[model samples]
Target chain A: MTLAEYKYADTIHRCFRCGYCKFPVNWMDVNNCPAYARFRMETYSCGGRLWLTKAWLSNEIDWSEHLAQILYSCTACKNCEEKCPLRFNVDIFNMIQAARAEMVERGLVPAAVKEFLENVQRHGNPYGNAREGRGEWSQETGIEQYQGQDYLYYVGCVGSYDTRAQQTARTLGKVLLRSGVSFGVLGSEENCDGNEVNALGEETLFEMLAEENVRKFKDLGVTNIVTLSPHSYNAFKNDYAKYDGSFPVLHYTQLLRDLITDGKLDVSGGMNARVTYHDPCFLGRWNGEYDAPRQVLSAIPGIELVEMEKNRESTLCCGGGGGNFYTDFLGGSENSPARIRVREAATTGASVLAVACPNCMTMLEDAVKAEGLEDKLVVKDVSEIVGEVCGIG
Target chain B: MDIIACIKRIPDTSEADTIKIDPSQMSIEKGSLVFKINDWDEYALETAVQLKERTGGSLIAVTVGPKEWDDVLRRALAMGADRAIRVDQDMVAADCHSVAIVLAALTRSLPYDLVLCGAQSEDFGCGQLGVMVAEMLGVPHAALVVGLQEEEGKVRVDRELEAGILESYTIELPALLTIQTGINRPRYISLGGIKRAMKKELQVMSPGELGLTAEMLAPQVKLERLEFPPRGKEAVLIPGTPEESAEHLASILQSAGIF
Candidate 1:
């Protein structure tokens, strides 16, 4: 490709294909890049994609569904960016997303991806359910719609749509009320955070969603937004600001951590369980929120908090990011990263694999069942743990 | 060359869980739902765009709906349609015949070398409007057209049939063709593209503007109450290893007497 055509052509050249992006910090294993780890192919890695992208842009290769799938397979977990020693690590993920944006402009995306985007376009959420149902879960959950409340509970698409994740959303609401935290939910008024939309390469649609949400938040006078999905938290906390949306955002785990630290809620520690926290890629690596979830988990009196070898920044992805949950690119295969993550979590000897993001909760839960480890290990959201400990669930 | 593409706005039922019968039981409750260009209509719009690109024609998109349907027409404009038209109305349940009458009236007024329409509307699936419009206009018609090619004075089409069969036919120019799905990959319109197309010609006309009274456009058929199908057998979630699941599925197939 011409140097001027690609946005980060210079930085992309700086990659020099060192291959460090395919390993963890410990380098004990090589399956660090989730797509590469799953595919066992060089073409799926960050550097390989970069080379392919250059060739395709330069007209050396024609675009194919295979190339698009490889590009779309990335979860944008940032593991490759994290492990890369190059100074242009930040450009790596953005470059992949940029390439996807180009592919979207050309209408060369996967069929599932097309359906995913068309749904997100029609419905406010990616699930394609009516917007009315988005607010239906807040009923009977003691969560009121925001009317100048202290914080707006911005339940992202998964929590608002998926039945299993709805429990986590409700639990978060209950936990907040029990701790006497002042919060109100946007309910149906809350739009998709457009984080995954941005990652999926619908830049224009993402901009529309982000702008509309920001305008609505500004109109509501919302100062803080607590999200049940790390996907939304990442977008609200970081990406929104780029569009002139400056609002404080916290993953539910961060707020739970704060509540426990303030001693506002009483935990009898009545029930005991062995649990390990699954650091969501968006929460931990994308935003560097390693301690908040862990600190809250540690404070629970009846819990034995353990760690998997691949935890925190070096954590394996749930293979649900970048709209992969709806795309099913990672499922139906043993090499699915979520299955790999659950199998690793099983090694920690913990019965419950706790997660902070709704996307992660769904991914790992299915992965547990797919790997036939559901009987041995269960997946639960971090809020579920707090709900259990506080006798709220 | 001139081409006219008929489109419709329909509530997305991709996720059927949220769809419900309205209080009147005649139509779906679309107040909280999202509406989009009908799926087959999207393919039709793409087909018209592709034909215009290759044959150097002015493509005009037309829809029969209320004011909110302008979004679909705007999208059509962004997809390279030279202009858009909306037959404004206030019908909650439009029948295929009524819509065909309106579309045929609109088609008669325009200078069109060819007419294209979706095989069926998503919500109704009547599969009648295109052929009915063609009959009213007294033009040759091709339905379920999976492929099309322009000739000197005619258009050749591959009509889809049941069981993956295809029937080829060549219809004369100035005829109507109802496009099937996968005729082409529809282009994605950026928000910027739509914003730019907002400046394009988008004409809105009521039935009165077409010299048609409310009675002339009234639906010939009235919809009865809609209800869900009766549940017969309960569905069981078959969860286990792949081999076990396969064995379970084979038994299920056998119970249905397929083997």
Candidate 2:
């Protein structure tokens, strides 16, 4: 049997859907599901989805039109798998996405997904905006393109396109340049890593984009790839190989941590402010990359690395995974549990909120602003804080 | 129809911390590298078995990990799969591209109406193997198969899209389909089935058997090293007068976003 068939036939045949893997309390850390932490419903929990998938497979349950909607509810956070005592590989979100893809092939996916896919296929981005003006952030910067630079900082779709995220991209560029790390931009030739596409279950399109990005990276002869977003880092580090290209991938902080560790970076002035680092889900949980950024923070002279109750592998989600940041699908904006996490970070008595990923920055920054606590604390990426300490700001 | 389902033996990520490693990175504290069915593959396997019940077919399981994967393969068999296949060589590199190439070469001779896979593996999260396999086999693929319908001379399918969207298409026979989650709930292995699976046939092969050279297996992405994330300072709860504690608590809660 082919690998695809082998995996499918193998997984479905083995999964029992006993619901033993799910957490009893949705918000409990012992339970690995972030969605349930917010939704507090069996329908949105990993075990519930597993049972539903088993029922559908057994012909005991029929696919209603709403089946697709139910499948997309998960963030694919892998929290439930962590909670499972039997080690059931309960990938309800990802598997549901694959199943939904098959259903889409048979005209089974929700209409919204169909439209989004159509746009992505046409526009080279999931958001379906013009690709011509993609890298507007680099337009005014002195940075050039693919000039045999040792590091090629690939700003992702959101960093390049979204206006708010543009600040993050620009800030990252400035910090890298200030630190004397020679880096170049991908500019218009850049494309989505198909990270979100794969996450959302559009594997074919994800492949196409991955292929394009791989070709571009190879053509540039770029040795090292540094990204502003952890999602992009996770994809390039883990997913790029599927498309036949590979590079050492790092989020900006990882690279900065290396620079700090090697004594390439030295921040002289003592800030005396305590800081708390919020772990991005993709960086921490998805790939087990939780250290380098904090190491950089630790090496700094006077910054105290304050811990939140939920941190590292147990860090609470900022409610931004699975494209939830673009839309409040779960109504987290009105009643955000992540804001509570932000509040938790605030309670650490830290003057600054140190973040690694651009998404975390965006979410926590907004949370800080929304709670009107901007006067008390500030949200900054580790790179940004390092840049400031180095007198680059 | 005869279908073979490919699975993997992944270290349980939940207890990944429990997997203690020495500084050299060799397995020092030999905790269980627990075996479970690959997540997406489970969906694929369930789909194949269910499709077999409808269209009539046999299900065979496949994997490439340590010999211990036989336990997982047996679990698949216990859940109603027919047989098992294992590639019995120490896989040095964990890169997806290399793994896919090896898997494709191994399955080149297998017979089936369709090939199914999860879009990506959970452990590595690389959604490339199924597509790479299709490229190797010179077959059309409909990945992220959210919907499926059998048709004359071809199969109709639905591919999941972003924001709750899906696209409908049709592909000819012998095409690859990457099964998504939620298509079907996978079956649980009964104790009786597990006993029965113990006696089933299991085929094993090595990398050399598949003509994979060390150069081909070399991983493009290197981890360099793994570091533990920095720990936050212990919360120093202020204890004393309400006013003093509240003032202190206010500062702490202010940092934690109590406001």
Number of clashing pairs per prediction, in order: 0, 69
Evaluated against the true structure, the overall lDDT of model 1 is: 0.87
**CA deviation > 4 Å runs, candidate 1:** A1-5, A268-272, B17-28, B89-94, B108-111, B150-153, B206-219, B222-259
State the lDDT at A92 in candidate 1.
85
Error of 1 at A146 (Å): 2.6
Looking at model 2, residue B8 earns an lDDT score of 72
lDDT of 1 by residue, A264-367 (tens): 86665744888999888999899999999888888877789999888887888889999998897767778889988899999989999999988888889999
TM-scores of the candidates are 0.91, 0.57
lDDT of 2 by residue, A1-393 (tens): 222442354464455545544432244543335555566677766666655655565567787655665665565555555445553364445565666555544334454554455445545555666555577778776767866799999888778877767776877787777668888997877777667667766666677788888888888788998998888998999888878878988888888888777767776564678999888888887888889888888888898888877677667777666655553344445346457666888899898998877666777788887777788889987877886787654
| TM-score of chain A, every prediction, order shown | 0.97, 0.88
